[model samples]
Target: MTTTQDISQLYPNALWNWFAQICAIPHPSKYEAKLSAHIQQWAAEKGLPVVVDHVGNLIIRKAATAGMENCKTVVIQAHLDMVPQKNADKQHDFVLDAIEPRIDGEWVKANGTTLGADNGIGMASALAILGADDIPHGPLEVLLTVDEEAGMTGAFGLQAGMLNAEILINTDSEQEGEIYMGCAGGVDAEIRLPLSTENTPSGLRQYTLYISGLKGGHSGVNIHLGRGNANKLLARFLAGHANELGIRISDISGGTLRNAIPREAQCRFLIAPEQVTLLNQRIAQYEQILNSELRQTEPALKVRVEESDTQADKVLSLSAQTRWINLLNACPNGVIRMSDDIPGVTETSLNLGVISIENGHGRALCLIRSLIDTGREQVESMLTSLSDIAGAEISLSGCYPGWKPDTSSPVMKIVKDTYESIYHKEPDIMVIHAGLECGLFKKHYPELDMVSIGPTIRFPHGPDEMVNIKTVGQYWELLLAVLARIPQKTA
Candidate 1:
């Protein structure tokens, strides 16, 4: 047996072992077959009732132990999929490989790829509770949904009348101290720009304008942080000089994920050799302006302009390049509005997530998120109008509803009481901007009162993802306390 630097010593005995075993599985989004099966097998081994839905969601129900029979059943929910993101140089296949997670004191992180600690830790907690007989609790049902990252396919496909639990605890929140009661609804707008090119002007030199090194993050959750969008910024520069420098584009590319803010974007094209000096001067001026704008949030923003390997024969058609710049400049990025109800919260936002030029087609993707339906519609409608103007093919997907918070729930009072009893302090209750499965789950079980909580995680949906080992214990304790306090049904 190969033991690759164990970190089981960091967590409590049972949970430590459970998390370690979970880290050994490769459960990337849309590729959760093995992980789902492993969960089913574990349930079978424990002699629990386990069922796999049509979409591979595994729901395992453990009957109430002797004394806890009368207590209400509590659903512990978490996704089984992980985001598969790695650094530009790392070469690990998420579909066929497991994360090599390591412990840095109290923080547990992966080597180079994303740790999947976001939901994996939550799943591990649920499994540990289900597997152990020592933990004190009421009747428990674990709902392990698949493909949460790419889309909430499992949550969407959940059959009616499937769950008996009237109260749910979603252990997917990233922050440790606060409880998330709501989240913004989101949708992805995909625009494919048709490409048609012409010949390059002779005597023009080829150059590559590159931008990289900005800390990209979740478009919805971190959009208000003032992080720079490389695609939009790059377009600003190109639009400023497209005609002045006789610039022509060959190709344009940017960020990877639709849910993440674009950190880097690059464009290759030809410009007059004599105008290179002028271009350099303009680039420096733009860099200063952008740096000043993003100083607080994206301090490490970088831009590089270099000479390209062109045989003096290839260059983008002037007409195509012109249209591309027009579209890029027209596309919207950043927070659209501030919430009127919740002070200091962004009510609506859009991220110009991706751009690609390939095979005579230039495509762009934008993500729009909002707590209010009208705000979401406004931004999406604007994108559709832009697509029509640019003559680009457009599509949208991954639409999800917002989880409107119920401040007067009886379950909320129970949870607050439990927390106060355990820690002697009030837990901060707020809503998050990131997408969560609770919204969809509530659609199926409207009577269900749900609240989400979890350990502190940093840099989620990115390669530097890490979960605080200490907070896991506190979160576990809180969940168990809530479960134990559920009102018993009188026979």
Candidate 2:
């Protein structure tokens, strides 16, 4: 029940005000029209030149400071859309309702919903920089891409001649001290399994097997934390007891975004009345086992089996159910390999982010990410091979290239030196496992120098998303320092 007035009291008035305005306007992925218009109007009000690309990407240009006219143009980039996720019991409409922001000690969070701060804060920072008169900078262009969460449509369709900035500063990284020079590329794998149904067996009771309370997070950023996947968990339970308990699944579904770890799942299935006790016992046993395995990361995990009053006249054929469960169990859902080049960084990973069954068919959508093309291809092939054996059709889409790191770049050196000078300590210059727009930008502008940085945000793409208040101030300062020190363009 937090209000805008409460959130507006936070530090850095210009940045928070812009972010608050952004949150007030619902800007979920693929539905960014309103927020896009808001940006255009705001830019116009400031008298800055603005252009909207065909794909809804926004570019607002600011003239150079008096003495900094000789420096190269720097592009401040951020996504315009956000992942819309909320708690199970929260009654919120993402398309029409504004996110309720609250101050939680040292962080800003939404009430039972994902705070759009993943890129909203970054976007707000860019806007603040554009509107500020005190800050010194070279030519500035703010590139706000669209649909970066659910899809990279804007990045994929970015026109080459639209942006003229030689240096791109992507303000989308989550951690404060980490400067991200590169990030993993990704592809989406879709598996479709044809379903076979039969009449519900007489004397069989329909029940719902529910999996919830898992602390699902951004699949790429938190995949290594060993959090449970609800789709996999529910499928595993059904697979383990399908034969013994005579389980006939009628419908199965869970998760939404392909980039977020599934936190909840449920399935309707028919079982003999005699097996009800055994079903409850199995759920209890699995809950204990899962809790023990993921106690540190997913301490609130719950697996519930409840009797449902609704009845189904049809259920999936036993063979179809078996195949479905087996395939879900066989699919990989976590970090596949760690980086040999970057110690402690994930080199290859897969997130079984969404699953749904309808109209005699089921589909599993997964997001595969890797720092190298070979790693991405290997994972894709593995998924296709698994789908082939399970008699399911597989397809891949939205394959984006990874940004190769350049440690010796002038921009990288400038940012690093600026951070060390300000903090009196070395910041971690690392490559992220998450997919970023920098990869796409590199392809369009191969000669452009780029780096990604942002405030500390935790649990993005989920209800627990929050941004650290203190880190925002530090991030703002560092950005200002980096802009002031951008070397003059050479002949």
Candidate 3:
């Protein structure tokens, strides 16, 4: 059978080998027990001390190398769980099937599924360091948290004084040759619109409207990419033509994760037999419009319609359908504000990630992110007002704080100096628009100094996710240099 040894032969064997093993396990967010147990077993085989905290966070401790014991303790952190996303036609089950990894040119990708390189690569790096024989470092603690994608449950539940490390190096950032000092806060907004359903009218034919092929991506990172949101596009079509076409909605669903832009949506509708031709014409026209609008960002955008033989059990009331359409059209999406302090950075943004109809009720999920709490609150308030007017009940949950950048951080200086020394150039230091666990860790460890770094990963939280192979080597080298340079504790 294939093993990690075969995969590790390409390059950066230590890191890639560990990543290969990780991909062999199904560790989707909130369902990581098997992967956690695998990690515990590996630690046991290596004779290392490991513990699982009350919330399932894993911590593994490694002693300092010779002559480096006087340095202050350091923590290397990465999340264990991954966001599960796959292409519409891909048959892999995230809960049961392992991700199939392949090398493409200079990057490592999966077979029409998210490669999980966002944190998987980071996790592999930490594991490689822990298992190394010659790397010089102070006492090292590897923190592997769970359920970071669906929510920051692991980071939130971390008890105070659970870790004694004064310095934390987060291996979760996506870009290489950059140091992330801060990240935005985020909140999940859920809206439920009540609906009433009735028997399908006789002589009405059933048809399914599909919106697919949109280039969905991370809501925070790709919000400004101008990619089409499938839910919004479908909603616009239905809302625009419902009254004229006498459309009756039977069911609607789109998207799965709150952090991923919806890539596909399907809606079943009932209409008079005579309206089928006209509806098809309108769908084709709308598809052309979307193609023209998103051609630059999403050349593969598709909108298709097909007739169904089976009849729908029930259809939403005309009034409820209209309200649902209006609600989707009214909801604000994409970037709302730009940062004045950080040029070219999104200050506030929102993503309409999910929509579904079940049991005569419609639900929509949105993720709102902002660098400032005021900006986040403003968007939340706006959503609340919009939902109220649409007669929908809205609730917020899984709110997490933002990390404020510290320009004068000692750890930042050390990392920057190490990067310049190795590459003969200064590394880009900036704050990200996406949420990071550093924010939650800061709340628990007020005195901890933290920074995030990682290899170049692209299109995370989606099927297009991939990691640059060469950058992994660079990142590993830089991390080791930083570890060796950690300042000795003061007497």
Q: Against the hidden reference, what TM-scores do the models get?
A: 0.93, 0.99, 0.98
Candidate 2 lDDT by residue in tens digits, 1-491: 56877766677888998899999999999999999898899889989999988998999999999999999999999999999999999999999999999888899999999999999999999999998999999988999999999879999989889998999999999999999999999999999999898888899898888999988999999998888999999888877888898888889999998999999999998899999998888888999999898899888988988888989989888888888899999999899999999999999999999999966788999999999999999999999899989999999999999999998888988888999999999999999999999999877799999999999999999999999999998999999999999878889
Tens-digit lDDT track of model 3 for 75-151 = 99999999999998999899999988887788888888998987999999899998889889999999999999999
Which parts of model 3 have CA positions greater than 4 angstroms off? 1-6
Cα-lDDT of candidate 1: 0.83
Instruction: Give the local distance difference test score of model 3.
Output: 0.91
Native-to-model Cα distance after best TM-score fit, residue 145 in candidate 2, in Å: 0.3
TM-score of candidate 1 versus the correct structure, residues matched by position = 0.93
Arrange candidates by TM-score, descending: 2, 3, 1
Using lDDT as the measure, what is the rank order of every candidate, best first? 2, 3, 1
Q: Could you give the C-alpha RMSD of every candidate to the true structure, in order shown?
A: 2.6, 1.0, 1.4
Q: Give the per-residue Cα lDDT of candidate 1 at 327.
A: 94
- Give the worst 10-residue stretch by lDDT in candidate 1: 1-10
lDDT winner between 1 and 3, please give it.
3
Assess each prediction's global lDDT (C-alpha) against the native.
0.83, 0.92, 0.91
Find the 10 residues in a row with the least total lDDT in model 3.
1-10
